[model samples]
Target: MDDAIRKAEILIEALGYIHAFRHRQVVIKLGGSAMEEPAALRSTLQSILFLAAVGLRPVLVHGGGKPIDRAMTAANLPTKKVLGRRYTDEATLAIVAKVLREDINDSIVRQMRELGGRAVSLHTGSTQALFGERLKLKGPDGELVDLGNVGEVNKIDGDLISSFTDAGLIPVLPCLAYDAHGNWLNVNADTAAAAVAGFLKAAKLILLTDTPGILRDRQDPKTLISSLNEAESRKLIAEGIIDSGMIPKVEACFDCLRSGVEQTHVIDGRLRYSLLLEIFTKSGIGTEIRL
Candidate 1:
């Protein structure tokens, strides 16, 4: 295809998405191995800016567990991983807050500024206590453990996030949250994103993952499931077909849908312009979980 024709096609498609999503809120859960890659990082930023420029409100909830692990190792602190979930101890919790909230959140804001979007950081602890719950995930020593100070989000201050959206500013969120007593807690980024989306009554929730989408066969990338309703998703989970790293994400998607989010998408973050393709193209590149 000629360059000008391709550009025109992309422009038209982007305009279509903008028209369809204007005045709608979208919560994006950014994670997986893709974010670590420079190209993927650039793509994600570009996509966010594009969405914002087109009048779609986007709230970015980011994960920094891998960087936290690396920082912990460098600091000679012990790290734990069980069932693909990180077990956060007191030390780990401190590190997580620093990395996710300060470092990662600030970096995203800086990039957004460069992308011509006004962005700011939102920390759960600083704003208000939006999550509370204790869950245990196994540790590196292969023993049953308590993930101290960890949290599962049960609430979100929609007004606070919405205020930013109303101001034409994108809210960049960290996975860390706090309890009613102001106790800091670590939360799964995907879970955090879903809770926020539900609270804000967002029109869409987009989860960027390493996989292409939800696969009928985990071993086969081409066996992607294009769409699924909430009940059918639960059936798949009951059958134990959704396992491993995909489990939490899939569950989060379902949770968001049940909580009244219009649409939830799980897409491959590795592909450049994957976000645009999924949102603006006729043939999307990921699984779309809808209510």
Candidate 2:
């Protein structure tokens, strides 16, 4: 009886959030260890399905770095990184496209269906919702460094994505976009998700990563910062607390916030139902960045 009562109380706690977020779009960027672990990925997908079932429009964007690496190895290609970003040559881009579209994207859609949720794949090989130009980086010496097939998201098909969400289907997009010349470009998943959120003017953008939000001490999970504003987030970045891979994620949040997204969250996707806890619970289990 006590266990049942506690479950009912949990539902009551979530009621307000459900009502508030109904029909509001929420963009989720899913990657990191969660994608590699069966249980974590299952739980995260279930949470997303729950959100859709309750009337919140959820769009999923994913990155498959580990699988891509494995595919590259099988094809005897060397994996390269420049400034913590993948340096995609033609060969690498081919492998990336195959792994992300044929393997990861299709698998996610299939899983969602198996789990009794409707999902559709939107990538270069399909609906091609994202479009961008090739990306170039600068070295410390101010020299233009070419990251061959890499690109940044320039535009998203808001109407098409909206159509899917409006019809009670989740659109699963792999972090690959098409250039104006009809070439496929490798885009950072975090940036792609942010662009989608910004274009749709989503209510919130949630990045599901491996870490337990942003921690003051990188080595300690207990030091997580539950909430911070844009200024504070920038300060943390300058202080070196938020460095490397985390910088892009934080910047993605900044982009979404600037585009009028109400809030952005970085949470540990490895935790079961972390998405639900972050969105529905009063004391969220992640770091929320607001303007």
Candidate 3:
């Protein structure tokens, strides 16, 4: 087959997905070591822009935990985490705010704009889209761990986000939220994206992370499970196969699915155009969880 003809074939194959998802919404949670590599990050963002350009509404929610850690290290502040969730005190919240709101959020918007895609920063702390109280986490001994200034999603401004997506603008939402008392709180990006997807009842919640989706065997890449339903996913969690940090991610998928999102996808961000492949092709590269 000629290369040009092969390219056309690819597009023809993608046409089915384009038709199905046209004018629908996909909430993307971008995270992990993928963000540290400039090439991979650029490619992922370009894929998102392509989705937006092709008439799909995309809401981007991101976390800059690595950069926040660097900032803390520079400031001589001790970094800590309980159960893989950051412990954000007042001082740490400031670093989180700066890294998420000022740095990462603006940079994503600028990148999207530079690529000819219009994106608006909708940081919950700034946009008043999310309001929450402090989050109390549990330890192994069943003790409540006080992670000050860290919040779980209590409320989200669905209408406000809708107005932006409805107007054809990509919203770049960060993990920083605000409490009722107007205090800033650091929300986990995975849960944040899940909450946003559930609020909009989005068609798909796509999470781009470091691993090869959900692997049946942690050591083998070939053990990647391409698809799983809600029950199977929950069973993985219950069996401790999806323990640790991955637990939150899979739980977020379950949350979105239960809230009417048709599917949740976990794709490897290291691969170029992975999002496009996962969404458009018949056999996707990652694990897709459906109802």
Candidate 4:
């Protein structure tokens, strides 16, 4: 009876958030070690289900980094990573599309269905083409280097996403997009999510990652910063506290905030119910980025 009462109380506590975000759109970027571990993946997906069931329209942008690596290994292709971003060549791009669409995206949709939720995959080709542009990476000398087949979200298909959400369906977006010339391009999932959130003018952009949010010291859990703004984030980057791969993720959140997204959150997806804890409770679990 005590446990039942506690559960009821928790639901009541979540009532306010559920009502506040009702009918609003939220973009979720899900991946990393969170997808690799079965238990973490299940818990996180269930949280997403909960969000949808409660009336907030949720969209998912997912990554397949590990799966792409495995595909590259099978193809006997050399994997080159620069600044936490993959140097995607022609061969590697092919595998990225295959793994992202066929393996990771399809599997996630299947899993979402299994959990009693309706999910749809936004295929990477022209019919969907979540983003329509190519990406330019930085060179060793700080020059803009063009990484072949990599994209950085120039535009998004807002209507397509809205069309699905309007029908009470969750849209599972692939990180890959189309270039100006009608070619497929690989995009980082974080960048993809930020762009989507900005286009949707979403209420929030939630990133489900492996870490315990952003820490003042990467090595120390006790150094976690629960909230941050764009200026503070820039200062951290200038100080090298936020560099390499983390730079892009942080920049993406900042960009989202600047583009009118209300808030962006980076949370530890490994902890069960972390999504609910961050949204429904007074104190969120991760570092929330705002203006």
Candidate 5:
């Protein structure tokens, strides 16, 4: 069939990309609208399997923040978010850690295995006391308060990630971490992914977010800027063009680029094979930020 031939061609192209990037480490932050949509979730799982089958080294760091919020609400716990990071108090942190480490993490491992990919899920505290700083935020009502357990990633162990990757197991890292004194802290998944990418000197940091990429004009889809550097991103932030949920995403991209990650990409994971399109095609589906 002609369709079969077309499919074969596509697969061959994908194989070429894999052969080219073989043994190169790629850290993927799989989250945002992609995780929220049923179709997107299936596509991402399949994409990972395809990448592994083709011999492209892939490491995944996923976000379950939205799921945790739903669980908290279902459990009748008071939930609050500061600067987009969940405020996990002593009580909430227990619930969060349980959901993140036990529920979401296990599900990812199970799904990846079902797809024939060797996936190993892990929590930050499993290896060591990776640290973060608690952030203060203004409440929804504009009240300034310190949100406990909601922190920004300050440190991570690259050795653990490398060991897992070197053994041919894809590391599916959860965003839950522990303080130096053994307190549980919740880190933003984007920041956590970028940290891991930096530590490993990964060749690529691919963020599977909702938006197609960074658009110069938020209202204009065609205004998507293909690439940016640290200084350019900071200037955009200073100009107030970059704010809201984009701040952390931009920060993560900048961090990865500064730390020698070859290229950082923010793509709309809603597409079935956006990762492949970005990797193999000339025109990609999202933004590519570099140093």
Candidate 6:
């Protein structure tokens, strides 16, 4: 009886949140070790389906870096990184496309269906919801550095995405987009999810990663920052507290905030039901960046 009462209390705690978020969109970016573990991935998908079941629309954008790397190795292609971003040449781009579209995206959609959720793949082969142009970068010497086949998102097909959500279906997208010249480009999944959130004016943007949000001490999990503002986040970046892969994730949050999204969160995806806890609980288990 005690355990049953506890379960009822949990539902009562979440009731207000469920009502508030009903019919509102939430964009989730899935990556890191969360995707590598089968059990964790299924748990995360179940949480997403729970969100959908309660009437909140959810959109998922995924990254397949580990899988892509393995695929490239099998193809005998040398993987290159330029300034923390993948330098995708023709061969590398082909493998990336294949892995993202055929493997990762399909697997996610199929798994969601098996979990009793309605999901549709929105990629270059499908509705092609995301579009962008080639991305160019610069080296330390201020000279142009070519990152072939990599691109940044510029436009999103919000209407098409809305159509899917309206029909009570979740839209799953890969980190691949088409350019105006009909070329496929590799995009960073974090930024891709942020762009989608911005275009849809989503109520929340959640990035599920390996770490326990942003910490003052990288080695200490207890030092996690529960809430952050834009100015403080930039100060931390300038102070070198936020660096490397985390920099892009923080910047993605800033982009979502600037575009009028209410809040953005970075949480530990490896934790079971972290998604539900972050959204439904009063004391969320992640760092929330708000304007």
Predictions in order: lDDT? 0.83, 0.94, 0.88, 0.88, 0.80, 0.94
Clashing pairs in 6: none
TM-score of every prediction relative to native: 0.90, 0.98, 0.95, 0.95, 0.87, 0.98
Query: What lDDT tens digits, residue by residue, belong to model 5 across residues 14-117?
Result: 67667777787898887777877878887888887677666667888888777887888899997776565666788898887887778877887897888778
* Total clashes in model 3, counting residue pairs 3 or more apart in sequence or in different chains: 0
Task: Indicate the worst ten consecutive residues by lDDT in candidate 3.
Answer: 123-132
Show where candidate 5 strays beyond 4 Å.
Answer: 1-16, 124-145
lDDT-best of 2 and 5: 2
Clashes of 5: 0
Which residue segments of model 2 deviate by more than 4 Å? Answer: none
What overall lDDT, based on C-alpha atoms, would model 4 receive against the true structure?
Answer: 0.88
Candidate 4 residue runs with Cα over 4 Å from true position: 124-129, 140-142
Residue 120, model 3: Cα distance from true site in angstroms: 0.5
Candidate 5 local Cα displacement, residue 237, angstroms? 2.7
**For model 4, the run of ten residues with the poorest summed lDDT:** 124-133
Residue pairs in collision within model 5 = none
lDDT of 2: 0.94
> What would the per-residue lDDT of candidate 4 be over residues 6-68, giving only the tens digit for each residue?
999988999999999999999999888888899999998899989999999999999999888
Which portions of model 3 show Cα errors greater than 4 Å?
124-126
- After best superposition, candidate 4 residue 87: deviation in angstroms? 1.7
